[model samples]
Target: MPSLLSSAIAHPARNQHLLLLQSSVAQTCLPVLRDVVQRSMERAREKTILFCLLYPPLSFLDKASRAQTDRLLVVDRTTYVPGYSDGLDFNDDVASFLRSAIMDSIQSSSLNIVIDSVDTLLSDINSVSATTRILSELLSIVRTRGGTSRLIIHVLAPCPLLPILTQTRFSPSLTHLIAHPTALLTHIASAYLTLPPPLSPPEKFWGVFIPISERHYESEKLVYGSAGEGSGLQDFVVEILVRGGADATGRRRGVERELEGWSPALGGPCEVRELDSLKSLCSEKPATEMQIVPDPTQNLPFNLNLTQEQAKSRAQVPLPYAHEGKPPVQASMPAAILYDPDSADDLDDDDPDEDLDI
Candidate 1:
């Protein structure tokens, strides 16, 4: 049987690379991130590990059993005051500390670095270009190491920058710096994974994973993808992870009771006693009489200028067709009379000689 890590990754024992995971809701994806980190730790037993958490505190890391490993180095930069912490200040060289830490980690033995939320880093820097530059440098360092070192970046899905990038047509320079930050990371990363919002119960969520440069066979495709003949390309694969009930220790006694009588051998065959009773009750009731109401508009006075007899005669007569044998007769044109301007002036003089005095 394949392990969880083997199933998720194309090759578990690969070189240094980047993996990005994104989701709309943070809570829904935290578990998935934890799962990946746990799996990574299992694979890289002697490797140096670094966790840079931006959203949750050190206590949240305990949930993922990070406390068990002494090799795990955690940088709790989740809390920062605008004026108090000079090194953690967001406005001035915000990512300088983070960059330094990542650089130090890459220099050590085969390293595994996990940045909890890249969205928080971008928010603090407040400059897309600067934040992107910082991330690019960090990724470059990891790739340069080219060993078991890997970088996992978690970001929120449907990133706020996506809409601005898509709606507004910006210049090439601005577009490169500002638009769809997650999309930019996706292109940079060796593999990308996205977590959709959780269902109503919040126990399960869907994840899509795509390996950038790796070629996968049709048999290696996900359950749904395995059905059709694949193009032998690195296709995006989807997996659903179901988290057991919050209280795993407590057995559901009520559910067990409900299932007790569900066995056919013990309860006998199923019968529809209610169906016959319902039919008997319905037969006792008399059929209802439906009354048709006359239209109110029927008595309305619509005064068209035709009598009942004239309307009947008009309705009986068929309309004449232009295509019938009876051709339409054209009216004769009257002869045009020619009038000279000089003759008209003489006629006007005769008519108005008495009326107008020269």
Candidate 2:
């Protein structure tokens, strides 16, 4: 049986490289990224590490709720460490420890890391030079592990680093950890999901996140060169809601909050035109005659207007007389008119001739 990650990965032979990012790191590009986590959760591999970069603490909650991995370990600079008794430790040393702990956790459980906000982490790194060094070391440690653990770093920075991530490689403990970008990366990810557009028109696009291959191990790459087919793509819809720092246990309450705000599914029934139309179904009134208002918008079978003679003749016609009334009463309309002329020819001509003579 194929692993969950293998199944989630479509066409591993053609394209290789997975670049998974939070649909939104900031408020601007949410619609595109909101469903990213949900879809990612459905299509996640057991040994995959989802690195998330979020700005607000609440945002972290949302991301965590949507995509659950084997182990969820949060690393935040803003929060205090519980065990540190000395008036809450807040130093780079603690951050380093947390990073190492994360790597250790990964080793125990296939080494999957969810960095909530890489952009934020980069920003918080006291020294870009030293911080990068620390990250390099951690990534190196992760790569050296015997287990084939995949690392997904979600970087929120959009301007330069975002585009250059593929070409860029920092020295890792193991040289192969240098990440590269590919078509599979772009195909698996939807750029539209991260676009900061108006909320009214909810049009979204799908993009695939392919894994960056190691320079030496070509065959070890999950996806190859062809760019996998589109049959494996999944569609998702996402909405964001303001969670007021609630102690909610599950992801649903957060979703409910979002639904309450957006109300995406509020258009009501298509055929129901007026409140009165809905009243019939809701109230269940036993009406003797339900007046059907002619929908001018709809195509109707019967003509609305009729001449006086036509109205009188139609009024004289009995309802389904062919089925209800006596069987041989008489042939209807055209049949009566079409009857043999010889049957009525006995008396009419003689009376007409007498009138002409007078």
Candidate 3:
């Protein structure tokens, strides 16, 4: 998949922005989480604060630099539960703890709040309304402060809330997926980005960055233009390739690269009719054919050369700026006279003397 950091950077957040990164599998999101943390660390000197609600736990952050970790304030996901042995509760309010963390981060620097997975949090809380309220409050806080806060969230794809009809058969339409957890997150987010599922098993590591809203896609399309003719929304697909390697600590690391020429259309199942309609609308209009008209004077063998006198007269003619009646205003003295010390005495002599006090 494409590097989440690079994609996020490309779609820069304005002041008080919320960003969502939705995918089906939680593991697929790890690379992006690491990348964002590292980027936050690099910019920490600029007073960037990162608050991470790590559902997968602190071990996921081990690959991040010490500086990155120092800049981060994390809330263990277990704390959200009331009776869990490892849970940390203050006044029995997980909402309060989250608010406090956000406020503290804002006080120090611009906040970058990342929640590993809202779906997991919702499940833990077992109250969608309560979780939604908390999220709404946090978003409001960021907006009211007028400080640019990038709230990055990961949501599971094929969301659990999506109704399953039978064990073998599934809802094949996008309408069924609209009520997914990520969809709810989308309603509040400033930008909704999706990491589309891979095409083939071999290409499973590759994904495309797609904007959640058509309006946003249109605005971007106007600015960047279509990628190619007949390409449809696939023209805007930014391919992200996930690679595995070792960090300085010899721990297995995952990194992302932005590849070229890959289209989202090639990956995952989509509503064909909707895509077809959009393709028809966005397709480039063909150029109109027109006959070239010959210049009226092209074949005329008229005198093309000007006489010396005529040329001289043309050259001598005053330009539009040079009025015929008024002399041009001289704002400064001649270079020679201005620079010459001898001319200074002459200029002084020309000045009328005033009566001196006796």
Model 3 C-alpha lDDT versus the unseen true structure: 0.42
TM-score of 3: 0.39
Per-model lDDT: 0.40, 0.34, 0.42
- In model 1, which range of ten residues has the least summed lDDT? 254-263
Segments of candidate 1 deviating more than 4 angstroms: 1-6, 9-13, 45-53, 57-60, 63-70, 83-86, 89-109, 160-358
List all candidate RMSDs to the true structure.
Answer: 21.6, 19.9, 20.9
lDDT of 3 at 46: 23
Better of 1 and 3 by lDDT: 3
What is the Å distance of residue 319 in model 2 from its true position? 72
Candidate 3 ranges with C-alpha deviation above 4 Å: 1-11, 45-60, 63-70, 78-82, 89-109, 160-358
TM values, all candidates: 0.39, 0.32, 0.39
TM-score of 2: 0.32
RMSD of 1: 21.6
